[model samples]
Target: MRPQLLALLARAPAYGYELKQGLEQTFGPAYPQPNIGQIYVTLGRLEKGGLIRGQEVAQDGRPDKKVYEITEEGIQELAEWFAAPTEGPRVRDEFFMKLVLAPGTELADQLTLINNQRRHCLTMMRGLNRLAAEEQGNRVSQLLIEGAVLHLQADLDWLERCQEELT
Candidate 1:
C-alpha cells in the first residue's frame, strides 16, 4: 500500500467507491485495476490510524455511506511517506513465472505477447504525449505527464532493444 494515503484522501473527501475509482484510473488502462475490498480495507486502516475522519452520509436507497476527510496527521504522514524510499518493487509476474517453469512455451507465442506489450506501451506513450500537448501552458501538469510519458518511452525502447538482441 502507498503511504500517501492521506495525501490521496486530501485530494477530495471521498467514500470507498470514489477512492477506488480515482486510484484505479490514475495510471490509465495500462495495468491491473484495484478492487473495492482493497479500497475499503485501506480506508478502514487509515481511519484506525486517525489519518482520516469519517462522517456518515445518508443515502435514500440504502444504508449510510462513510466519507473520509484527511486529517492533519494524515498530511504529515503523507509527507513522510513521500520522503521514504521504496524497496525493490513487488511484482506479481505469474506469466513470467509460467514461462520459466514451462520451458517449451512456444517461442512464437512468447514473441506475440512481447509484440502486443510493445504495441500497448506505444499507444499509452502516444496518449500521454497528446494529453501533455494539450496542457502547453500548465507547466506542472505538463511536466508530470511528460515524466509519465518518458517512463513509457523508456520501456518501449527497452523492449525494442530486447527484440533486436533476441533476433
Candidate 2:
C-alpha cells in the first residue's frame, strides 16, 4: 500500500480521500480497498520517513486538507521496487505442513485433505472466472484474475501429485 500510494503521489499531489479514490479507480475490485483511516496512517508514516511531503491547504468552508507529494527518495524507492523481482510461494506452506503432519497424528486422512483442497481451488477458480467476466473492460483486473486462476491451477496440479505419492 505504501508503494502504491507513492506511485500515485509520484503522478501528482493529492489529499488522502483523493488517493483512496485513485486506488479504487485504478485497481477496481481486483485489489482490496484501503480504508481512509489506513490511508491517513500510511501518509503520516511516509511523511515521517521523508518519502513524501504534505502541505495543509485551507478550504473555503471546510477544514484544511493535507495534500501529499512524493519526494526524490520516494521516487528512488519506487524505482528499486520496480526493479526488484518478487519471490515465489515458500515450500513450507500451511497445507504442505498439514499434509506431512496430520496423518501421523491421525487428525485427517491425506487423501481427504487433498480432495478438499482440490474442491476449494476449483470453487475459487469459478469465482475468479465470474469476476473476470464482470471486469472484462478492465485489463488490469483481468490480468490479476488470470494470475490467480493460474496459481489455483498449479495448486490443483500439486494436489494431484500429492495424491499419487501419499494415497
Best by lDDT: 2
Question: How many pairs of residues in model 2 come into backbone collision?
Answer: 0
- TM-score against native, each model: 0.56, 0.95
The stretch of ten residues in a row with the least summed lDDT in candidate 2 is 23-32
Give the top-scoring candidate (TM-score): 2
Q: Roughly what TM-score does model 1 have, to 2 decimal places?
A: 0.56
lDDT score, residue 35, model 1? Answer: 80
| RMSD per model, one decimal | 5.5, 1.2
Alpha-carbon RMSD, candidate 1: 5.5
Q: Single out the weakest 10-residue window by summed lDDT for candidate 1.
A: 94-103
